[model samples]
Target: MLAPTTVPMPGLPERVRIYEVGPRDGLQNEAAVVPVAVKAELVTRLVGAGLRTVEVTSFVRPDLVPQLADAEELWAGLARSPGVRYPVLVPNVRGLDRALAAGVEEIAVFGSATESFAQRNLGRSVEESLTMFAPVVATAREHGVPVRAYLSMCFGDPWEGEVPPERVADVAARLMALGCTELSLGDTIGVATAGHVQALLDALAEVGLGVERLAVHFHDTYGQALANTLAALQRGITTVDAAAGGLGGCPFARSASGNLATEDLVWFLHGLGIDTGVDLPALVATSTWLAAHLGRPSPSRAVRALAHQPSPS
Candidate 1:
């Protein structure tokens, strides 16, 4: 496992938090439901590799996302790692109830920045979905739970072309208004480029949402996820969302592809001397093992290269 040369970037954060979404977002879109034990192992391996924040599973309707139907079972049986945060996605109050029952410490709500995605994903208009999340956020807050808001389709929509930055900002502000401590801007369709990434961050700043409250989630559909991420990092964003082995896509959006690979992200960050506290070889090996379970090769370039690298003479 060869490492990248360190060329420290100017004006970058000393440390970047990689929000590992492999367990939840990565598995949700799988055609086959992974066993609860395997899911638990994945989280255990990721935590072992130094991902402090891992989204373990989603509390969505079981029938809707059968792949994560064992969320409760998995969470109950998962080995808790000290100093690590395990967050779950709760769609509405019912989902929040299940999460609360499992003693979830952190929760994230999914919202759409466009009406088309709102209807398609959440079965409601943008405002109606927000109305639905209101009680969920309120209840979680009452339980002393911190909320994270995921805003999908922030850049472009497959059905609706080019979403406006101002529109995204408005929806993001409303979601944050619901008491979400962090907001992750999602490039759901993977149509966003580096310029689009900065523009949206600028728009959010205009609406008083600073980079401190922001994280970025990008898909590699157009091979832009890493570049878009770099642009966001340049804008002072310290949190990034990535999935191991580049495992998942939007179940609702047919064009959506796998997320930014955690391995690839780590390689790029390490090259620039940014600390992610992740062990490169351990992370690659984890993705490699998980890929074997899925019966496919990993989509991450770094994983493929590192996992198959020749031993040094």
Candidate 2:
């Protein structure tokens, strides 16, 4: 059997990529509609805090996700930074077309590991949903725009409990074959444990899918996001997706909580002596600012802890 190759084993990269999804995933599920200007400012502030890749928004039907109704406007308001990426989520061909017209350089497509979640969230069977993304991916390839893939419900599904890791690996391999430059495995219901994470990574590796092409998106619903993230890091999976202020939940999965807070993830990364090129203080300030617009206190423990720290006089 191949030995476990986790972090600190010359496998983990010293520099990790934090794909900030706060602007898109976080806001898309918010109850209140976020103004385009505020959303644009949130992206700017997060980038100011050194987030190199921020998902600005998704291009779903406005009737379905009103929070991100201003996807085009938000994109228009953003000032592109050299060497920075702003990827928007595109579900199908139409969404991809909208993204391309907006001059998007990179975009992400989402699929589900389970059929039930796919039907609930994507309105189709898992197979059919992936089929829907084929043309979108092909079109993006023609335009020289890179595509990242997301597989939700990788761990457990509300309707189908205890999903097999092989199931996720199967979908991951297919997504990679479908022209996804990177694949993010998501614990949509937030029930993934540390053991579950390592097992899944091992299964993925068995299929010739290494950590090099993978990322993780975890929710703090059961308070296992950080622990699960540590397990992923130990496996040398460097790219982690997080939401600033921990501000998000699955509208399709109402029982699920928000994502792992970006501030919280950054705090964990910095404590491990890993470099994310992010300023914790600056990130916390951005969350605090956004929290006010949302009319709620920031949900990030790191942000709250830092908020109490005495500032330099």
Off by over 4 Å in 1: none
Tell me the RMSD of model 1 versus the true structure.
Answer: 0.7
Model 2 Cα shift for residue 234 (angstroms): 1.0
Clashing pairs in 2: 6-234, 7-234
Quantify all predictions' global Cα lDDT against the true fold. 0.94, 0.89
- The candidate 1 region of ten consecutive residues with least summed lDDT is 304-313
For residues 12-47, what per-residue lDDT tens digits would candidate 1 score against the true structure?
A: 888999999999999998887788999999999999
Clashing pairs counted in every model: 0, 2
Q: Across residues 1-313, which tens digit of lDDT does each residue of candidate 2 receive?
A: 1111233434556888999999989988887787888988898999999999999999999999998889998898798789899999998999999999999999999899999999999999988987898889989989999999999999999998989999999988887888888999999989999999999999999998999999999999999999999899989899999999998878888778999999988888776778899988889889988988988899898888887677656
Q: Model 1, residue 129: displacement in angstroms?
A: 0.7
Q: What is the lDDT of residue 56 in candidate 2?
A: 93
Candidate 1 lDDT (Cα, whole model)?
Answer: 0.94
